[model samples]
Target: MSTSEPVPDPSAVAAHSAPDAPRAHAGSAATPALRVRTLRLEDEIDLPAHLPRDLTAAWLRHGQGMVGIGTAWTCTTSGPDRFEDASARFRELAAAARIDDEVGTRGSGLIAFGSFSYSASSPRPSTLLVPRAILGVLDNDPFLTLVDVLDEQEDAPDAAGAAPTDWRDLFPSTPRAERTRVQIDPDHTPDEYQELVRRALGMIEEGRAQKIVLSESSTVHLEQAQPVATLLSRLAESYPTTWVYHLSDVIGATPEMLADTEHGRLFSRVLAGSRPVAEGSELAEQDRRAFRSDAKELAEHAFAIDSVTSRLADLTTEITASAEPFVLRLPGLEHLASDVAGELREGVTSLDVAGRLHPSAAVSGTPREAADAAIAELEVRDRGGYASPVGWMDAEGDGQWAIALRMAHLETPTRVRVQSGGGLVAGSDPVLEHAEALAKSRPVLRAIGRPED
Candidate 1:
């Protein structure tokens, strides 16, 4: 990893003509850059769900260095129906903001989307922003620098040095539900579900792929409408340790990982939900102990650890993984957890690890390929961004990326697509699997102003 500090004021960097801007070098010295754009629903006339995916994939295939992208939209109710029409409006906003010119640009940047349900009591209009820059000192350290940028932008004078909105305000707080009621649809059945698990287990047994991560999604019809923000707040508060993240139109809440690229580090707290990482927290020791020892849960966690370690061993010179798995608890569920570390080999990059370890066993199954194929066949809808990797990376081969969960895709208030899935194993039950999918989606469902039935 590059040993450099982020520019205190990224905006202060001397601007060069668009054509003359210094290009980012993959492994060379160059300071990463940050730029933000403001977007509104009116800007997006009509957009497609695959636009963002296409843009991101194209960048990964052709662009160098780091990248970050974000989009936000507002849900609006039209007539008695026509929710899908509204969703299209939001998607258009996202497509309009794509960074097409950055394909040949040097360095790295990120693109993302954000939005809120139209019914949100605190209706803060949504905005989608994308930043691009050549990787340099800033590339080495992202989250801190990015967080700083967010802070700066949030604090920047808005015609008057008024606060745009703190992170807290962007995501509102709500009461926690002691027992989250979830509903699953038994009608939608995909035959590939069972085959995927079998294929994954077969691969592990065959040694073709030591470990594979597989994921599956199930659509849910809530009992009642619940506010998306309230749901997210409850999940975040319930599982404070998890790296809770929300995307405009994806599914599920993810709170287990954070990336610190500058130090050549990828910090993952591979436990699920709300389990304790320390001793003196809200959860009792006995509860934590029970969570830690559950065989089924531990098996789920061990797959993640082994997969991560195997990938790191191939990319780094040295590695250290926690010997024992622990418990991770969230508002609605709990999971086993562990941590893994390694020093990136001189020329190796996190992207390499990301490519190798993505779809970790936590998301997929024991063997990767079979599980992925199974998911593709079994799932009722194209996941688009739901389970795919989402995060930022820079030119220095530094940036953080995490599984895009607890997310939704907003076409409009009336027309939105929400997705959720679970890791299935031999012993996995359809009923339980369906329930788990619902539990995972709680975060995004709540964010979009949907009431939990």
Candidate 2:
């Protein structure tokens, strides 16, 4: 049951935020050694699962791409000016790409898998990378992309170009333990998070800002470091409908769609307004109706929709949005979800759309700048790629960018920092929001083999 649907776009969502642009490669900028050529592989393969040795895995439904960064010419960038920096580098790299599209499709050529930090101020984990070798599975068939690092005199595809045949081993097997003990750091106690929430709500009351998204970061100590594949596979299995991604050390299943663009058609799904179906809460119709009618939830959802539509309106034409938000049910929660679709203007790259619509009210808040300032002043710790855009873009500018949410950064093998945040609006209760943050962490927490309490 492999569906090769085009990828779609997310929310805990700000792991690290950045306006992504720079890309650093192995060679000096003057003598760019990048020579990328993609071949349509005749063989079918499972992506992420059978990724080449040490390759990064990314998937959105059936369409996926894996890249072996090891020995692969790679480009990385970080800093306050990373977005513009990475963008310039990507343009240069894409210019160097030479594609032999035997079976022309979205993922058949040079592509980059990226994870931007949630903010420019926190630059530690921000990355925009181009893999030396890309294995993309599109429409059940895979395409093998080979990148060459050539000297001034050399010009030809690498020896492996004869056939698209590859059977590279997938490393990082799943962990065997049923569960590992997890120690949630005390610095991010619920009380601390609640206080932040209270402060934001107070600001809303005082006309400081209509809304602000407040978040907390919790570090979990795992008994051991599980292979990233283990958590990615778990996320894919447990949240089959969501986009599962792993780049560098940032990994998780994101439920919201930031935006996806294909052949000029664009799709953006914004999810906000959460209702937790606690450990044993009934999913009764009466409860459903009450939640749908809840004023606070509706307000939150409206802000997200407005934020998306307002931004998309500038970059697209014939935009249309669902009049009402439908209930998006995940494992332990439900969210008010609205979809906006439009026809993109000419020359608009998917990343361009992502940059314009990011930090939407769904993840950022009603007034984006105000929420950002609040987050910077309060959350203090680096988000490490939590809520930024995490997805892939290609040479042709077709791609899917999902908001980094429901994620954690693997600071080290033994430590993964889980991130969660909620929209703070007037009349919001801090206690429930605290619970919501905990609920958001459940995905990453569960991924690390945390035992059920």
Candidate 3:
């Protein structure tokens, strides 16, 4: 890695340029008001298994989290102003929305699930979606919340028509039996991916950037349209440690938490170096020890650590980071991981923290702009939502946001793109880096039933 000067703190930098005023979306002025009602359920329910095929949004880990059904309101924005524009509009709506809570829990009241693109220039619009109904299990308490958008006269519908009285009515009666076979094909030749890695190494050699992350995608061709809920249930069951997420067509289990704000506290988990673990190897300690001592991996990890702490220091108080990184073992891979936390400064929303900490050295390279420029030039593909912040935030400005990793995007009924990438330093081997990307992709591949890679 280059011994170049460290990148400036992201908080010190100007926020992404946004319109002077928030632009309206479907849930904005179009609907005069939104009425939200939360009710506790008598029986506990499995969160992912109940996710419906259409208009579903979820963020779950260890079988506990929120699942949103049907869109009550949604906002889409693009360009540099995407985050700011969406955040402003959400704050406005949440502040105005009405709520009647019979079950007071973390995810109750008005909540919006969101996914942002990795780059401002991406053609895909970043989105924030408020579900018409929410099925959630936090701290083992099963509950449901319904949101009803009021018409122009600002009058809510009749009580019977406004919200479902029984939580059982909200869940699907039976699992869909429909299934489809999937074929995983490389979107780009291995040689092409290696060339991109070589170019990134050249940039590092020339001191253009310290470390750059390069990613590639694979096309998962399905024989026919498959139910997303089934695929998500598989992922949740297989990778209980990861946050299995679904926002629109985007679905995956991410191991990295970009930012999680709750009850006046902020927390984050950063992951960088990675190595594949044999599926059922009993002696994985050897690989774990080797990964820990590797100088290149340590260097890559340090950059990610500094990037997070610096940005967090600006938005939080009493900030502290993990003393040493620990190996986080997953289904087919393990990563060097560290946790950072602090007490939130007043009025600093989770989205605000995400904006400052995003493009962290783990995803983008050190000296953020240079690495971003390198990614744009070398990859030559719009990273629609890969490596971006994908999670949900509540009306209270407290929410969990995870880096969109180990994910696949369903482009259409028959086409899905599974993507993965790794960090590259001065001595990064193109061949090895390419292999690492494939290793990182194992989780999603295994989830979709193609474990033999």
Candidate 4:
């Protein structure tokens, strides 16, 4: 997407409005470029705290990542080819860009923060957005990058000359959230969801699929609209280790990485199998041990790992995976977790790898095609953006994308939909699966300031 209109002055950090249209192509100008200028900052930034209240986009994890305001351009598409469409559009923008990067790091120039829906059939279009101004921190160093699209008539500005001495002054004011209460309503009743899991197990037994992931959502109705920044800040504070993201209407703190590609390296974290970790340390450790040894959980986790590696094998070299999954502890549960790494092929972008890795046995089921069919037949409610990829990719096609887990969709000012699910195998227990889904929902629920029921 490109625009011929003159971009706002780089010195102005105030929020600006983006076009409402889906695609903004560079008009048939003789020359058009996506111009990016990076200015390294002198001080360290305290994330979530330093994040502005009205952030348009963000991808933060472990106190690093970027927060952006306003939209410079957008590449939005729907249906099965969404990933390809967005990737091609971004590649064009990046290929023709003019960049001055003093920082010259992974995320230093021309970044598009993206969030894709879980299903291609979803009416909600997946988005790749380029924010007008960005403040980011990577490798413990902070920097500011001003992004714009320039037509043949405009001249690219100098980075150092336009940068402010005090980068802090660029930020807008943040306001506190009003204490709010929410009305929660599950999409499927406990019994209904249990029946769904039972049906999935039946399908597995009948040889339709080896495993199927079933999810449930609860609509959170607020008395009044709550600021998304407040919820983002709360999630970041509580789950600092998870990727805290807010792109358009989707917001979450996800622990599972769908893909993280930098230079030629590809890294992914696959999570499956779960045990709710309540209060007692001894009990939690016991649960962790039992979880590690449980045949059902181990089998479920194995399916997830294989799903990732098999796909990586096609796009990467020297692929490596953990021999055994480690216990990944979170606020309310522990997951069987494994890390997979590889070197990407010459032309594979992060999105390409993500499209292939998504709906892995971790999220879908083994025998992907069969599992997805079962999900369509059995699942009454749509998954929306849950279990999908959400993150940013720089102009270099190097970026991070995480499964949109532990997340909620702000459907409106007052209504947020929170979702969670678990993998189901032939011997899975419906009641236990329902409990596990609830356990997975805790982080977002707690972040919303509500105790889990």
Cα lDDT, all candidates: 0.41, 0.69, 0.78, 0.78
TM-score of 1: 0.52
Q: Candidates' TM-scores?
A: 0.52, 0.86, 0.90, 0.90
Ten-residue region with minimum lDDT total, candidate 3: 1-10
lDDT of 1 by residue, 147-192 (tens): 1122233533122111233222222223222333334443245545
Candidate 1 vs. truth: CA RMSD? 15.1
- The deviation in Å at residue 322 for candidate 1 is 0.9
**Model 4 C-alpha lDDT per residue in residues 1-453, reported as the tens digit of each score:** 222222211211112333222123443343236677888888768756776655678788887888876666666667888888788877877888888899987788888888888888887778887776788888888889876556435454322122333556655444457646777889888899998888889889999999999888898877656666677777887888999998877888999998999889999999999887673332346666787999999999999999999877879877999989998877777788999999999988899989888878899998999999998898777787889999999887888999999998877766788998999987789999999899788888766655333
lDDT of 4: 0.78
Candidate 4, superposed: residue stretches over 4 Å from native = 1-32, 154-166, 279-283, 451-453
Residue 402 Cα positional deviation in candidate 1, in Å, after optimal superposition: 1.5
Worst 10 residues of 1 by lDDT: 7-16
- Superposed by TM-score, candidate 1 places the C-alpha of residue 313 at a distance from the truth, in angstroms, of 2.2
- Model 1, clash count? 87
